[model samples]
Target: MTVNDKLQADWEPKSDAVQRDQRAAYDEMRERCPVAYSDFLEWSVFRHEDIVRVLMDPDTFSNAASRHLSVPDGMDPPEHTEYRRMIVQYFQPERVDAFEPQCREIAAKRLQSLLGRDELEFIGDFAHWFAVRIQSASLGWPLEMCEPLRLWTQKNHQATFAQDRPAMAEIAKEFEGYVHELLQIRRAAGAQASDDITGSLLRQYVQGRPLRDEEIVSIVRNWTVGEVGTISAALGILVHYLAQHPDLQQQLRTQPSLLPAAIDEILRIYGPLVSNRRITTRPVEIGGRKIAAGERISLIWISANRDGRVFEDPEAYRLDRDPTANLLYGAGIHVCPGAPLARMEMRVAMEEILGHTTRIDPIPERPPTGAVYPGSGFATLPLRVR
Candidate 1:
């Protein structure tokens, strides 16, 4: 059945109540209505078990939720397999290790600038720039593209939240234009094109055929959005949490080696990503709710990771929890291929921040603003760093 045929709102996803505190709101939903239907988000699966069921049974719940070309992200099975293979190679262990030094340099430089300030809006001043810089550097994009890309990410979030299809289409076109120009330059340069990730993609092939310009744009768009939006939100959540829990902050500061695990745990507690989309290929019953074929389903990562059934003391910060249970990078075939890169980036950034400063405390008068639906973490994180 089509969206219009659906009746009875189970919950309002875009409501002020949910947007005010998404984690709490999702936690309530997990217990109240694990599988719910609404106009905004048709079927939101909030329980850990239900989401895991969806992730594992991709045949029943398809990832092809978008009409636009989304490369592997919007594909399934045989098609998804080939493109996923090509995407994973770019983020192999060796490649991620090679990029660490540059990532550290970017983090260190950004941290140095903010060290002198007594108080600053962390998201705008530091987090966003770090995400944008590292993403551009990794892709070998021109330095001039950084600001525009940052602005584009912001606009993309706004468009998504508003569910403004026309604005989203325009934003997508804007990104395509940037990527197409880069591809054109690389093609014109031929052998002289810098041997970077972007250049490497130009040489990549799929199904015994060269990738088209639109495909390349789609891939790059996915990477950029994933990197910029999620990383920025993750950083805000990490620093904000550290500022609140001084004990964990000091622990991580002394034992920098524990950063990788700590970052994962913290992100799991307050997921950087709000939700991932999936469409039911056929009718399926989950959490005692019967969802029709072709129904839109959203796996609420924020809710699933915090479910007390799977995670004991769901709100508490503990590094000893089972890593396998954490859905920070997700699970199953569609798990984030860039998990390694994201982990490295977050680890390095946290290390630099903790090493550089003695304290990261929240401002008493100005509390950090929680980011609304379609966004995670702080909208403006005001903190004192010294």
Candidate 2:
């Protein structure tokens, strides 16, 4: 192959067809070009085993892929370990269980609002609403912050997809502004500050010193992004999946206890978060393709989890599938610290949805629109609920 041919993009991740249907596009890339490159994502890793190799060897493939600070998500080794240890406290079983009542309450309130509305756009009306509400409650933020946070997430996604450096920097600054205001409020309160997660972060110390304001903001920013963006997309995907599959929907409704496993399996079939970034720490060959040191990598989660080699009949929903192999919340040391909270939120949301509604069907005239690139799941999901 010529030098130009070897270096040229094997596939366009941001192309129109791929954006319309990412899972299918990634499936094609996995077979046709397992280690594809594009200007947008640099190197896109498709297969399950190859992605797993990258995940297992964080030293070789670093999580510090972005130029901006991502708190624990962008960190590795001793630094990642220290911050992750502190961040994980918020998602512990007890903490998650403690937040359950409130999560259900938020879901119930949302469902109540949708009552009697048979046909509605589920994305804005419910998914984003519930995600932000639950996130606000968990972080001790006022309900007033939900709309702004949701809007911020949308802008963040747009900037990320376009790779607009200036906009992304401004967006990051805007998020930091939101976080700073919260910090100031708690700092103003002194000893009387509410004993919630945000307040807890203020008190948290790392590396033998109290957390700085920027670090705290970065931490909260990561949490909010995961909670608001990923969870909202995931809810849309889950509800849309159920609306399309009558038998699975019926089964889930009949056995309410199965919602958690059903939720995982369904999400596995159609993942929410699209891809995560990694950078090659040294010259490495992935899937027989030589990648130079300092090159960027994109681990396509939606594609990796659905790999036919690792998963027999990958598209088929199976509660019996190996849980260990699923990269939904990711793998290795950088595995999402908020996974427990996310799973709980999804389960609670589904339980509330299924328990309240007798059926869920998609609106034929208004087919669900798929979210593109950095986002996953339906951008607009019109569902008929009864």
Supply the TM-score for candidate 1: 0.98
Error of 1 at 369 (Å): 0.5
Would you estimate the TM-scores of all the predictions?
0.98, 0.97
Q: Which stretches of candidate 1 lie over 4 Å from their true place?
A: 1-6
Alpha carbon lDDT of each predicted model? 0.92, 0.89
lDDT of 2 by residue, 1-386 (tens): 42234587788888999999998998899999999888777889999999999999999999998787779899888899999998888888999999999899889988988878979899999999888888888999988998888899899989988989999999999989988999899999999999999888999999999999999989888888888989999999999988999888999888988888888888888989888989988889989899888888999998898899999999998888989999999988988888998999999999999989989998888898989878889889999999
At residue 264, candidate 1 shows an lDDT of 90
Candidate 1 lDDT (Cα, 0 to 1): 0.92
lDDT of 1 at 170: 98
